[model samples]
Target: MKLDFNLKLTQEQRLVMTQQMQLSVKMLQMSGFELQEYIGKEVEENPVLDAEYDTNSNLKEKNNEIDYKKFIEYLNFDNYSGKNYYRNEEETVSPFTFISNKKSLKDYLNEQIIEVNEGEYTKEICKYIVENLDNRGYLDNTVENICEEIEAKKDDVEYALKVVQSLEPDGIACGDLKECLKIQLNKKGIKDENLFGLIDDCLELLANNKLGEISKKLKIKKSEVQRYVDFIRTLEPKPARGFYTGENVKYIAPDAYIRKIDGEYHIIMNDDILPKLKISPLYKNIVSSENNDNDNDTADYVKKKINNAMFLIKSIQHRKSTIYRVLEQIIDLQRDYFDYGKEYLKPMTLKEISYRIDMHESTVSRAIRDKYIYTNKGIVKIKDLFTVGISSQAYGDDISTIKIKNKIKECIESEDKKKPLSDQKICDILKKEDMNISRRTVAKYREELGIKSSSKRKRF
Candidate 1:
């Protein structure tokens, strides 16, 4: 091969993303909560950015307008009663009033230990057992191991285990699932031998709904086994299911609301949770001063800050408009779903919506990511509205797979318990309703819905 050095002029067009463009893309994907946190951090870093809460409902509609001077004058925070940095001191409310006083699982158990009239040594052992419990309220450590670790006798450890297990949840400190079931059963005064036998040995069979096998092994009538199964299903599998685990309860705020005004649906953007951003006039004044021509450093610094602040403000407005347009298209397409119920939910896709809105598919995807909307139906994620389409022969329009799955669930629920509908039977029923789906796809959707097979769902 021969090598030759040559240079040729070529013209080509290419697309590149600037840092501000990347930030705008990222801001579009952030949820309402995440965007608030991001804005809070940006306010701390950028001197020209000033964020203040806008409490007036009348002023919320003006957030999309890019008139910074007019917005600053209209969005004064002097009389604002909402949560913000610049709220009146007299209007501030104490935060401690909202603090949760509920005791955690361990704290709850310790309190019972303290109240018991047991010896101090035994109480200390009880505390150790409580500390060793898993989140499921089952003891993770063996009695022998506890005895060795705390230098206590095996009998004392066993007694302490009993004392801890006897606490309010009824199955706390249990060693295993069988023991937990037995403890809950005993607390409930259920003394059926068949129930105990099923819990002790046939839990796997019971879970799989193998009542016939259980009946054959336990030598009980199938009807009796069904009764025992029904009673066992009422028991709690996890003793700590409802107890607090020292984590904060997070609440979701919808990004927008669809309200029916004057018999017409309208999209209302939720601007309350977000801080209204504005550029500091001080920095703008500094940049516009002619005397600062000699102070290149100060002028450049002020100009850079002002540019960043303006970009941030524009990016926020773009995010709001993009989300609003995306949702407006969604509400138009899924109007029946919002007006009626989930049954009217139609199949939709990002590609279809992007085409209608004249934006890229990726931009549409980012607009709906982690975003939720409040409707007359309830709060639902915008992404959840985009369901896979299944061609329907009856309507001539594509139907949502969610609706098919819902129909299948209804068929199974209404079917006879002694003769549960098989996957093929469910498919045939859906076919009768003009939903043409194969048995395999029906089975797959059923599994996704956490439904068992016909054989496993059958009752004696």
Candidate 2:
């Protein structure tokens, strides 16, 4: 063996960082709302930077004419105190306050439990249980385990568990599916031995809507089994009642709006959220007029401040134009998806769009990060349309992985429940439909769609 200590490099590439480069990337990832907050903070910190808002500024100055009307319509008119509007209409008006008032699942449950009849020890145990519940409202720890940890008697824990179960959110405080179902059934006054046995013994099959097997095992008719199943289906699976408080409602303010006008899709950037920023003419004249004075230090200081202000304004303009260009390209590429739906979304990659738009792949990726587009359909995240492609069998054409997953879902929905399709069978079915996917690919797509295997999906 030969050992060499000398090293040589043929060629190398390196990235150099600058203030502008760092700011560009940071600005790209921020949404419209986040960017507004960031700009406000920057203005407060940097004396050289200033932001001014004018309600009378024409929105059409930045956006195209067609989109200007649609954007204004979305804004909607509201009457102020001076306007001669009806008093009853005041209740329907929405203010610009963006604060959210929402309580989490556990917090809501705890509040209710505190008001219930229970001893001090039992209430403490119940509080512990509520704190340990999973997001889906299932108790993560067993009662026995909790009793052992707390050094409390099993009866005390059991009493607390019962009280917790009786709280408003139906199936909470239970450890597993069996306990959840038993609590729900007990609340509904269902005490039939056959119904309890069916639930405890064959809940797996029961959940799959397999009425026949449950009927034969319990010596009951299929109609009776279905009636119970119908009742069970009405029960809420997630017992965390406060989970859907709408606290984390994500309001999307799109960067652009694309509309169909005269058989052509017109793209317009939404600059309503963006305040028109420019160097104050009065301030600029002050600096320029004092440049020839004897005080060199003052002149230099003014020049530096004016330059910083100009740079800040220019950055805002560049950011807006870059976002607008990127949105236009996305609208052009996803024209079919906007007209139709997700099914028509063609497979697109960052590199493809980057090349088309004469920007780097990283730049394009940053441009679309957290950005949104308002279309005729609704507000859609700009990044949601891109997906990896899988090749088809005939003519070797490629289809999107998302499309293949949708097809798999459709096949499962329409498949006969008596004989659920296996992974290989699903692959064959997809092959016939021109999606040349393998069994592994089928399993991957199935798992991604949250569909279980044939055995798990079987209807008994």
- Leading candidate by TM-score: 1
Residue-by-residue lDDT tens digits, candidate 1, 1-460 = 9999999999999989999999999999999999999999989999989898876444334556656554455444223323434532222243574796877789999999999989999999999999998999999998888888989999999998888988888889998999999999888887878788888889999988999999999999999999898988888889988898878866677888788778778998988879989888888888888899789999998889888888888988999999999988998899898888999999999999999999999999999999988776567889999998888778889989989999999999999999999999999999998998899999999999999999898988
Stretches of candidate 2 off by over 4 Å are 1-15, 53-93, 96-164, 173-178, 192-234, 242-248, 280-286, 289-305, 390-397
Q: What alpha-carbon RMSD in Å does predicted model 1 have with respect to the real structure?
A: 7.4
For model 2, the run of ten residues with the poorest summed lDDT: 84-93
Question: TM-score for every candidate vs. truth?
Answer: 0.87, 0.71
lDDT of 2: 0.76
CA displacement after TM-score superposition, residue 271 of candidate 2 (Å): 1.1
Query: How well is each residue in 266-340 modelled by candidate 2, as lDDT tens digits?
Result: 777777676655555665666678455777676677677677667666776777788788777767877778788
Residue pairs clashing in model 2 are none
The local lDDT score (0 to 100) that residue 227 gets in candidate 1 is 89
